[model samples]
Target: MTDSTSISLPADQRRREFIGGAKATFPLIVGAIPFGIIFGTLAEPSGLSAVGALAMSIIVFAGSSQFIVLGLLAAGAALPVIIATTFVVNLRHILYAANLVPKVRHLPQRWRILMAFGLTDETFAAVSSRYLQQEDIREAHWFYLGSFCAMYGNWVLCTAIGVALGEIFPDMTQWGLDFAMSVTFIGMVMPYLKNKPMWAAVIVAGAMAIATAALPHKLGLIIAALSGVAVGLSLQMLLTQTNTHSPAPDKEPQ
Candidate 1:
């Protein structure tokens, strides 16, 4: 099957959806600016050339993995080790793609490929609510593209600026601006904790993360993610059963 939002609408609706997506993603973009800049600032010191850094941001487009790679490189880790660590860190994208598959299951191959390339944590966070919460979206993929493109463009520009300023500043990454990423994530998640499954997932994930904080090679992250998924799934199953068994309301007289 192809991968798109499936439903088609008028050009006006598509434009509105696209604009809405861009506007919704703008705040997260603002938060990500510093994180992107810090990555760029640290890249050269981490043994990457300017072109290499820019290319990684453009090609890899994974902020977390890029930073992990840089850190591993700086620490003199073997190439295989660096690659494996980045792979492990990025496994969550699999879950992201699984969740999004239904929305884009009918699109053409090219659009699906573009959407996969553009899938980032920030864009996923912004786009999921729009797709899952709304019952009808005339052209949802356009909205997804809008958010993805805005974040992607912002990240590239920030990286470029950071790289250029890295030589002059030399300590930009050490400036404690990376905390904005945490704040941005918190903002994204807070609005969605509307039910037990969501809350369970977050709580279990947070607890697991804390408990496994000392694990080597960031194995703790994997544990936390898995535990959260299990908990969320279990809770969802229970909720589904409960709903299934509940008594039906009496029908009113016709």
Candidate 2:
């Protein structure tokens, strides 16, 4: 009885963690539904077939890059321009990967690759929050897998729905549905602004984004992201040095 119980416990724990991760992502999934549908609605008009749009959602699976591709196609951009533009837009993923590497380094390469394919803004937010709370959870990767599957399934289903509805509505993209994603992003970001470095980074990024809004191919976003990262790193290093050099408080009387 003891041996059987021991053998079953880990599987049970993994299942629970997976379910918990999926549940945690419900709100973000809600926010992304309309955005996915909007992309679906825009796909045909942007010269992509329904199959192509769905394939992109399945293969590329990056919401921002998919949207940019559609826009570039609509603008009649060259194939290389579309590829380069999407590549630039997704450079932010490098930062995400860097932050996660330490935490996931022990996983097998196959697991890491699968997780990387599923890493997105929503899954990253959900997984990172959990990892922050409990860094050594043995089942954390299952949680990440759950979150990824939930978001992926939701996005694909929503896109299909939009593709079907496009024939009926034909103007669903203009329904102002994409705003939900902006609100969702704000919600995702607001929780991390608990320190000076974070606050400075966000402010600088926001300001740079606004000031450079006129840049072509959405290069302003990249500029804003880099500016914020630089400012944040500088402030963080300065604070670390200050702490290291500061005098220790005198011990109370021995």
Candidate with top lDDT is 2
Candidate 1, pairs of clashing residues = 2-105, 2-107, 3-104, 3-107, 4-104, 4-107
For model 1, residues 51-118, the per-residue Cα lDDT tens digits are 99999999999999999999998999999898888888888888899998888888889999999999
What TM-score goes with each of the models? 0.90, 0.95
Q: Write the per-residue lDDT of candidate 2 for residues 1-254, one digit (tens) a residue.
A: 36998999899989988998899888999999999999999999999999999999999899999999999999999999999989888888888999899888889999999999999999999998999998576679999999999999999998899899999999787889989999999988998999999999999999999999999878999999999999999999999999999999999997
Instruction: State in Å the error of residue 49, model 1.
Output: 1.0
Per-model CA lDDT versus the true structure: 0.90, 0.92
Per-candidate clashes come to 6, 0
Measured with C-alpha atoms, the lDDT of residue 2 in candidate 1 is 53
**Number of the top TM-score candidate:** 2
Model 1: how far is 57 from its true place, Å? Answer: 0.5
Pairs of residues at least 3 apart in sequence or in different chains that clash in candidate 2:
none
Segments in model 2 whose C-alpha atoms lie over 4 Å from true places: 251-254
Please give the distance, in angstroms, between residue 80's alpha carbon in candidate 2 and its true position after superposition: 0.6
Candidate 2 global Cα RMSD: 1.5
